[model samples]
Target chain A: MFLVKIYVQLKKDILDAQGKATKKALESLGFEGVQDVRIGKEIRILLDGRDISEVSEKVRQMCDKLLINPVMEDYDFKIMEVEK
Target chain B: MKFGVVIFPGSSGEGDCFYVIKNIINKEVDYIWHKDLIKDIDTYDCIILPGGSSYGDYLRPGAIASKSPVMESIKEFAARGGLVLGICNGFQILLESGLLPGILLQNENIRFKCQYTQVRVENNKTPFTGQCSKGQVLKVAMAHGYGRYYAPEDVIKDLNKNGQIIFRYCDAQGEIEISANPNGSVENIAGISNKKGNVFGTMIHPERSSEEILNSSQGRVIFDSIIGYLKGVTVNGK
Candidate 1:
């Protein structure tokens, strides 16, 4: 079995309003020298498979096709074996 | 002329479009549910994607609904040069489905804006705006949290060069000023069209402006323009 963790974030060039607002809140809370803050989404999936490479490819395809909007977001994933 | 308003689950604006077509404009209209296969999409003169929180705006507004079955038929209908109009949430779906250029970001103010605003007609030659004169202004209601339009710089340049920009938020007198732009869209863009001018997507809800009781009938001109184009009549004697 494998546990996949996917992170999706707005592209660097795209404006992240929610992220910006959160950063402002942090500043108000007295977080000094906080340069920048960006928010993203994390999705976890479990697959009943043994081949890490094959499952990785399938996860990438899933991200490209539906999990992320390529126009404004970027995504990355990590896969690790989980004991059945 | 026949009109079909697509109804995605959680979409709340289909009824407004249906009312505009059947009651205000007095035309043939029907609802196309999202799950159904639209085998006869070619029979309709125009397919409308109305405003609403489709699929509960999950995973980004309109993202889930964009991949629904009916959108495939919408894509085919658009490819065949049929008119497609998407308003508000509909606009987001069009973008998510790649039926239109650009993406809609959250409003700069990060608040849901719902009010009557003026939009200057940038291009009236398209089927959806035939009744409008170039530079004319129309009062329309915009209600959405994500209506700020964004595109690659090159795409913006191309859209400008090709006159695909159909509407811009403007002052009552038709000045495209930043103060009038409620959502911080690039160049105050409120709407745009595909290169072929057959597919249009706008953030404004024209259907909400189609009645005198609504205090604005200017929105009726959009529907009139579609009827006019289908009837082969030139608007403004053009």
Candidate 2:
């Protein structure tokens, strides 16, 4: 078994409105010296796989197919073996 | 001519599109459920992807729904030169489905805006805007948080060069300015079409403003344009 952690973020050029709003809220809470904030999504998937190499490639394909939109977002993933 | 309004799992605006098409426009229309793989898609002259949060706006507004089996048929429908109109959430699906250019992001202000706004007809030559005159202002209602239209600079230039930009947010008098832009869309763009002009997507909910009882029936022009185009196609033996 493997647990894949995927993080998807808007492209650098795209503005993160939610992140900006959260940043303002943080400022209102008296946080100081905050430079910037960018929000992204994290998805975790647990699946059975043959091995690390195969799992890595499968996860990448999953991200490319349905998990992330290439038009405005980029994604990366990490896979860890787990006892079934 | 027949019209089909696609209804996704969480689609809340299909009823409105169906109402406008059947009750107001007096046409043959039906709901195409999301799970159904339409085999006789050619029976319909136009297909509408209406507004509202589909799949509960999961993983981005239209991301999940764009991969549904119904969207596969929609893509096929569009490729065959059938007119497809996507409003609000529908527009997002079009972008996600790669049927249209540009992406819709959260509004710059990070708030869900629901209000009456005017959009100027930037290109009337397309099938969807033929009933409207160039520069004609339309009173429509917009309701969404992720309505900001964006694309790479080169794509924006291509859209401009190809006359794919169909509508721009504008004042009542047709002045294109920043204040009139409800959602911080690039270049004040509110709507656009594919290069072939058979497919269109817009952030504005024209169905919401389609009736006289709504106090702003200006959106009727969009429906009228589609009906006009379908009629022309029929007359031309298509």
Index of the highest-DockQ prediction: 2
DockQ of each model against the real complex?
0.72, 0.82
lDDT of 1 by residue, B1-238 (tens): 8999999989999999999899989999999999988999888999999999998999989899999999999998899999999999999999999999889999988999989999999999989898899999999888999999999899999999999999999999999999999988999999999999999999999999999899898888889999999998857624
Index of the highest-lDDT prediction: 1
Off by over 4 Å in 1: none
Error of 2 at B103 (Å): 1.1
**How well is each residue in A1-84 modelled by candidate 2, as lDDT tens digits?**
999999999999898888999999999999999888999989999989999899989988888888888878998898999988
Weakest lDDT window of 10 consecutive positions for candidate 2 chain B: B229-238
Task: Sum up the clashes in candidate 1.
Answer: 0
Error of 2 at B30 (Å): 1.0
Put down candidate 2 lDDT per residue, B36-81, tens digits, no spaces.
Answer: 9999999999999999999889888999989989988889988989
